[model samples]
Target chain A: MMQEPQQAREAFRGGLRVPTSGCCPGWTQANLISLPREFAYDFLLFAQRNPKSCPVLDVTEPGETSASIFAGDLRTDLPAYTVYDHGEPIGQRTDVTDLWRDDLVSFLIGCSFTFEAALLDAAVPVRHLETGSNVPMFRTDRECRPAGGLAGPMVVSMRPIPAERVADAVRVTSRYPAVHGAPVHIGAPESLGITDLRSPDFGDPVRVEHGEVPIFWACGVTPQAAVMRSRPPFAIAHSPGHMAITDARDSDFLVP
Target chain B: MMQEPQQAREAFRGGLRVPTSGCCPGWTQANLISLPREFAYDFLLFAQRNPKSCPVLDVTEPGETSASIFAGDLRTDLPAYTVYDHGEPIGQRTDVTDLWRDDLVSFLIGCSFTFEAALLDAAVPVRHLETGSNVPMFRTDRECRPAGGLAGPMVVSMRPIPAERVADAVRVTSRYPAVHGAPVHIGAPESLGITDLRSPDFGDPVRVEHGEVPIFWACGVTPQAAVMRSRPPFAIAHSPGHMAITDARDSDFLVP
Candidate 1:
């Protein structure tokens, strides 16, 4: 069924723009990006330098409607998206709605599913889904490339894998670098320069087994790291845990 | 030299900050992080989630004077640094003498040298030094994990490496996870959703040889990506070419 972005957005109403991650269970979820025209070139350049932290999905031409590669319309595809002005949350509505601009650019990026399946295939249990808790994250001593008016830190999402499975975990996850492949830091938050595990930087804490080591992956939060410090004038994003589900699947991004 | 941060800053005032890379040589060349207290937690959390983009060097205790890691002091240390408030450049001062705040928190994190040396050891040539230009960067269709109230796209830096050296580059670099390790994306800008390579998103463009595939690494600029989009009320950082050099060395962080 080829439904228009606006029509798809309208169908969900207040319920639409919600994360489309689960809409198509087997499909991948992507991050959404909306930016002004002035910083477009620089921002695009920045993303290229920092792929793991900023996996590029689909981009739209300035003031254009459709995506660079993926299908669906930029203005109406997602059921929900947020709007920002001068780095402040001005509103949240399904679709870009009245906020679309000639200078605005849209981007979609791959999520963690590509590697998760690999982990699952390797029989490495992802603790969060088992316990139904959010993965624990910590700020480490890592940095990302800076460009234009963009700069800040790198973010990561950690999964607690069993001690015996750490090697397999790394092997499996390394296959998909597009959606954050491999662990940035293996164990000991302090080694990554993290002090506490109970208090996570983002998301809820997941249970770490007694012998398990915390395996961290570059998360989709690198952009958020910049906003908290620099506070760009305008930005919009999907709500936490809420993501855009793409027509693509995890198997599409495997390196092997 | 066991000099204080402020004292080290004084050295830069005497034309010492020039060619600042590896200035303290072995010291940690940190990407300065200064943000208003209102956004402190979110940013601290943002750094936690996107450690690669915003690593936690040493965050100044709120209203307290001094950093906990990397540098001995926040008043000064690096050869040079910059400050930004509300998405505008107020000034680039050798010392943050006039703008020091009780609420401001300073953060220092690991830099790429920890991994760059690995690349060099593996015989990977870094071109920016030869070309005397900034490493080219671009935006990617990627999203970092969101923390606090911050979120946006990912930014990255690029280097052209011979295709044969790719495996070595990944292997050598992967040993140092503290700094950005491993190539995020290897070749084909469009594959990562990047449309251009000559016109970078951040730094100056470097040369790409006939057989050299563009080898990209996670950059320190990812945080700037979020900062620009979120536009926190107040923030400070090392100017594009400037960094806070700490008491660190590239060899100290390698995995055996």
Candidate 2:
């Protein structure tokens, strides 16, 4: 009796409050962003300019509930939503029905979850998935290409891949440009201004064995950082790790 | 001693008015779109939803003439621009200096010129380039996914590739997703509602040899068609085959 939309509805109604990382094996997951109609253009332009950091998966018309890839309403479908006001986290709630407005626009962005499945299938180790912890992320010295009023330093997520298999990792991930694509930096933490891999800005660090190297990819958290820095009047995003599950298959994002 | 910007400046000043197909080797070429600030969000959303047909390369801030990729002013840099009013072409001019406004936003989209070079470099024959004619284009029965206020049938350009070399052609073009990446259809023209290979809705039809299969790619003209169909009060686009050249190389758009 639990069909796709029904399952999502269950999550919307508070029957499911867990992180969506491995919840649905083959479905695509998306990072969420919501803002007033006045600021949607600037936010979208920022994503267009810095595509690697903010690879937009789908966008909704102002005040519209559903998106191109998902059937459920945007306001309450996700398990949790974080509201931000003037760059400060106001609160987290199971539903935003009270906050929904006629002038709000929603944006769904590609998440690393889509490519992690590809990496796992290729036998490339996803350290965080194996350890049951979040992927380690860092704030880098590199500045994302700015657009409109949004501007900030690029943030990246790191995974340890065997040195010999690094080429294979690049090849496999390159096929999925929708999901942050390939590694931005390979084997050099110093280049990205991350001096100590043990101390990350976000998430827990994983082990890097003798034959492995740290590979960094542009993270979806980037737009969040930009929103925090720019401090628009109001904004909303899915709580990290609790993403919006879409009907699109993982293979749909791949290129030749 | 002429540099990259100098070439486009000369074109802006009326020294170059020909089709930009083979103008500067190795550089990137882009489709151009300009509109009032209010419609910018909708057009960008349309491009995002129907990426294959409208692969956005770069977008400019409102009232800004230069974009991230191009160094010259968009108002007069391109050799020719077409002005549209209520979905009808009103005039074609060498420059739109007199029509410049403080609220117009310019968009630079990826053109097929980038991938055509890759195809030729791989020794794949381009019939249009060889025969001195425009690539054959058609308006298909296929409808692009609607976004905001823009909606239209997807337009595609056809190239007859030798049956044996079809895979090679696909491999070469698939690397350039920034441009229209791979063929959306192959072999059967009827599948796309085209009854005659000898006739096309736009551009001249090229000869299809006995062993060649007609491969179709999503065309840059699609956004133009969508804009016209949407009937925005005002719009500006580059004249067909007259593109905005950029400093970025074609290889810059290629994935691993």
Each prediction's total of clashing residue pairs, residues at least 3 apart in sequence or on different chains, is 89, 0
Q: Per-residue lDDT for B1-256 in model 2, tens only? A: 1236557657565745656665576788898989899899888888888888888888887788887788887878887888989888888888888988878888888888778878888899999888877678888889998877889888888999999999998998888888888888988889999999899876688999989999998888887788778898888888777788887888889887
- Fraction of the true interface contacts (Cα pairs closer than 8 Å across chains) found in each model: 0.00, 0.60
Q: Write the per-residue lDDT of candidate 1 for residues B176-213, one digit (tens) a residue.
A: 55566567788888876788788887667777889998
Question: Every model's Cα RMSD, please?
Answer: 12.0, 2.8
A1-256, model 2: which lDDT tens digit per residue?
A: 2225448656666646655655566778888888889888888889998889899998888888888787777778887878989878798877888988888898898888778878888888888887877778888999988777788888898899999889999999888889899888998899888999998786687898899999998988787788888898888888766678887888888888
Interface RMSD of each: 11.8, 1.2
List the candidates' TM-scores in order: 0.49, 0.92
Q: Which prediction has the highest lDDT against the true structure? A: 2
Local distance difference test values of all predictions, in order: 0.64, 0.83
Clashing pairs in 2: none
**Model 1 misplaced regions, further than 4 Å:** A1-256, B1-10, B13-15, B22-26, B63-66
